[model samples]
Target: MEKKYPRLQIAKYVAADYFSAMVSWILFYTFRKKIIVAPLYDSVGQDLNDPTLIMGIVIIPLFWLLIYYLSGEYHNIYKKSRLQELGRTIFITTLGVIIIFFILILDDTIISYKNYYQSFLFLWGVHFSLTYLPRLIFTTRTIHKLHNHIIGFPTLIIGSDEQALQLYNDLQKKPKSAGNQIVGFVTINGGPKTPLSNHIPHLGNLNNLIETINNQKIEEVIIAIEPSEREKIQQILTKTKATNVMIKAIPDLLNILSGSVKMSSLFGVPLIELSHELMPAWQENVKRVMDVVLSSVALVVLSPFLLVLAIGVKLSSKGPVIYSHERVGRFGKLFNIYKFRSMYTDAEINGPALSSKNDPRVTPFGRMMRKMRFDELPQFYNVLKGDMSIVGPRPERQYYIQQIVDKAPYYLLLFKVRPGITSWGQVKFGYAENVEEMIERLNYDIIYLENMSIYIDLKIMIYTIKTIMEASGK
Candidate 1:
C-alpha cells in the first residue's frame, strides 16, 4: 500500500523550493539594505519596489531550480534518505551560494570587505534553512509512513526453501517495516509447494520470472535462495538484468569483506543491493546534454565534409548514399542506425555477414572511408536523434546480437546503454570479422559498461581518434 503519487510528491518539493528560494532572496535583499547599505549610506536605499529586488524575486528561484534539476535533487523523491539529503542539501547550498555570490552579490557597494562575508553567510544560512526545512519535513513524513508500514514497495521473494521462509519471517518480525511489502514468492527449484506457500502465493518458476514481475507490478525483489542453490543465483540475476526493479540478496561474509554490498538500514536484513544504474544521475544528464550539443555542433561544422562523403558514397556504388539498418539500442529497442554506405548494393544478399579486411563487398572509396571512419560520420545524426551516444558500445544487428548472446549471455548487459558511433570495443578490438571476434571484442565493452563515466567516455573517444588517424580500423 505504498503511496504512489510520485508526480504529486515532486510537485510538492518543487513548489517548496521555489517558495523558499524567493523568500530567501527577499530576506537577503532586505538584510543588505538594512544592515550593509543603510549603515554605509545612512539610508535604506533600495525599496521593495526596486527593479533589482523584483528581478531577484522573479529569477532567483528559477536559477535555484535549474541547479537542483542539474544536480538530480528531485530524483526518487519518495525514497530519499533524510541523512543523505541533509548532506546533499548542505553541499548544494554551499555551491549555489558561492555561484550566486560571485555572479550577483560580489560587486556590491559596502563599508568594508567584512560586508561581503556578512552577505554570503546571511544569504547561505537563510537559503539553506528555508530550502532544507521544507524538504526535511516532506522526507520525514514519507520515512515515517514507510517505517510504520503505512507505505511500502511491492516486493517479490525469489526463492522457495527454508532460507527463503526464514528471510521472510525475519522481515516480518522487524519492529519497523523496511518498506518491502512482500507480494509473493517465485520458486527457483520448481519443486512442490514448500512452507513458503503457507504464507504467500507462489507466483511461478524462473521460466516466467519477468512476466510475473511485470504482471505483479513488482518494485523490489529479494533473492533468498538456500546455500545449496547458490549456483542458480547467476541465472536469476541474468533474467532480472533488464528489469527496473530494485534487486537485493542475502549477503555472505565474502560479500561483506569484498565491499560488494551497501547497508541501507541498521536493523533491517543486511543484503547486497544490485544496482542497474551504469552512471550517476547527474552524470547521465550531463552526458546526454553533451551528446546533443556535441552532435549538433559536429553536424554543423562538418556539414560540407558530410556532403562530400554523401556524394562519394552515391558515386562509388549503386546503393543508397546513406545506409540505414535496424540495430538494437538501449533496453533492446530497435532503431535504424545511419552510416555512409560503404558496401555495394545488396552487399548482404547472401545473408547478414560481418565484413572481413579484404571483403569484396566493400567499394574502393568505401574501404578508404572505413579506414578513416568517414563512414561513421552519419551516425552523429543518430546521436542527435537520441538513438546513440558519441561514445558507447557499438550497436549490432539483432542477427549478430543473438549469436553473441548465445556465446556470452552477459552481452545483453550492453543493451543497458545507448550504442555509440565509436566505442571502447571498436577502439581496442577494431571491427569484428566473425561472431567469435565479436565475442572477443565484447570483453572490452563489458569493461566499458562496468566503468561508465563521462571521463571514461572521453578516454574512449581519444583512443578512437588515434585509431582513425592511424587508419587502423578494418
Candidate 2:
C-alpha cells in the first residue's frame, strides 16, 4: 500500500510553521529590545532590569499567535494561494502590532508623541517584515515547485465524456498552467469514450469514485460532466462535498463568456474557480504552526509528568506503558494513536469495548488519569504527528464510527478534519459510556464542525481545561 501522504505532508508543513514562528518571534524580540525600545534614552540610559520587558518576549509571540489564529491565518496549509496568504499576513500583523503598542509600548516614557509613533511603526515593521518575509520565501518556493511540475496536487478528472477528455488534454499539454498535475482520470458515466486514456490511465468507472479518490491520493477533482447530466452531477457533488478535496466544474461557454468565471494568470493560463476555499490558506498555516508549537511545548514541559504517568501505568496495570490503537483520522485514514496505558492489558481481550464510568477494565490510576485527562498527554505526539489536532472531534475506532454513521450519515463530516485530543464533545460530554451517549456527543461534535472558528476553538479549550481541573470528565 502506498502510504497516504496528505497527513504527513500537512504535518511537515505545520512543523515548518512552528519553527518559522519561533524564528520570527526571536527576531521580533531582539529588534524590540535593541532598536525599538533601546532608543528611548537620555545620557543616562533607562533601566534595563524591568521584568515587563522580559515578559514581553513571551507575551508578544503568544499574542501574535492568537491574532494569527483568530484571523484564520492557520487553517489549511496545503490549499493556500500566495496572494491570499500575503494579504492575510499583512492584515493580521498590522492589527497585532497596534494591539501590542497600545497594551505595552504606548505608556512608555517616550521623549515625545512622535517617538511613540516611531516606536510603534518600527515594531510593526520589524515584526511584519521578519514574519512575512520568511513566509513569502517559503510560499514562493512552493509555488515555483508547483508550477515547474516538481510538486503538484494529485488531481483526477471525474468525467470520461468529451468535456473530460478536453480538460485532460488541456491540463496535460500545459502542466504548469493548472496548479494541479493530473494523476489519472475516473469516468463518471457509461457515456462517450475519452481520448486522453493514452496519456492518463482510467482508474475506474463512476460507481467507485470515492474509493478511487481515496486509493489514488487525489487532492482535487474536476467534474467534466455535461450540463444535461444535472442529476448525476448533483449526486457526485453531494457525495464529494464531504471529502476534503477541491471540487471544480467547467462552466458552460455562455457562463464563461458572460464573466461568471474568475480567472487567474499564474504561469500564463486562465484558471477558474472550482469552489470557495474552505479556509483561507494563511489561517491554515497559522493553525498548523500553533498545533506544532503548543504540542512540542506541552510534550517538553510535561515530560516529567509524562514520565511519572508512564511509571504509574506500568506499576498499576499489566500492560505496556503506552497503548497504541488504530483509530480513524482525517479523510477516514487509520493511524495508531498513542495514549498512556489507562486500562488493563487484557481490557479488550473480549474484543473492543467502550469504557463506562465503572468499567472493571480500568485500573485505579487509569480511572484517575481518565478523569483528569492525563492519559491523553501522550497524544500531544499524535497532534505533532498530524494524526490528530489539539482541538477537533475525538477519533473513534472503525467499529464505533460505523455504528455512529449508521444512525447519522453526517458522522463522516468529522473525518474531514483531523481528530483532536480534546474536542467540544469530549469537553462538554466527557467520555461516552455507551453508543447512545456517543451518538449524543456526536451532535455537539457536528455543531463544532459547522461553527469551526478559532474563537470557538478557544472556547472549547477553556471548557476542556475547566473539565480537567474539576475532574468532571467521566
Task: Point to the candidate with the largest TM-score.
Answer: 1
Candidate 2 lDDT: 0.72
Candidate 1: clashing residue pairs, number: 0
User: Candidate 1 — what's its lDDT?
Assistant: 0.86
Q: How many backbone clashes does candidate 2 have?
A: 10
Tens digit of per-residue lDDT, candidate 1, span 374-410: 9999899999999999999999999998888888888
Tell me the tens digit of each residue's lDDT in model 2 across 1-474. Answer: 123345665455444445554555556545555655566533223334545555655565566666655565555554467798778777877887777778766776655578677676766666666677767766676666666666667888877767777776666676464457777777665633567576778888766777888888788877776666655754565456657787666655224222123644434434454443444555555666778999999999989988899889999968689899999998788899999988888888878999988998899999999999999889999999888888989999999987886777667767778899999899878889788899999999988876776678778889989998999877
TM-score of every model versus the real structure = 0.86, 0.66
Go through the candidates in order and give each one's C-alpha lDDT: 0.86, 0.72
Error of 2 at 436 (Å): 5.8
Quote the lDDT for 137 in model 1. 94
Weakest ten-residue segment in model 2 by summed lDDT: 252-261
Top-lDDT candidate index: 1
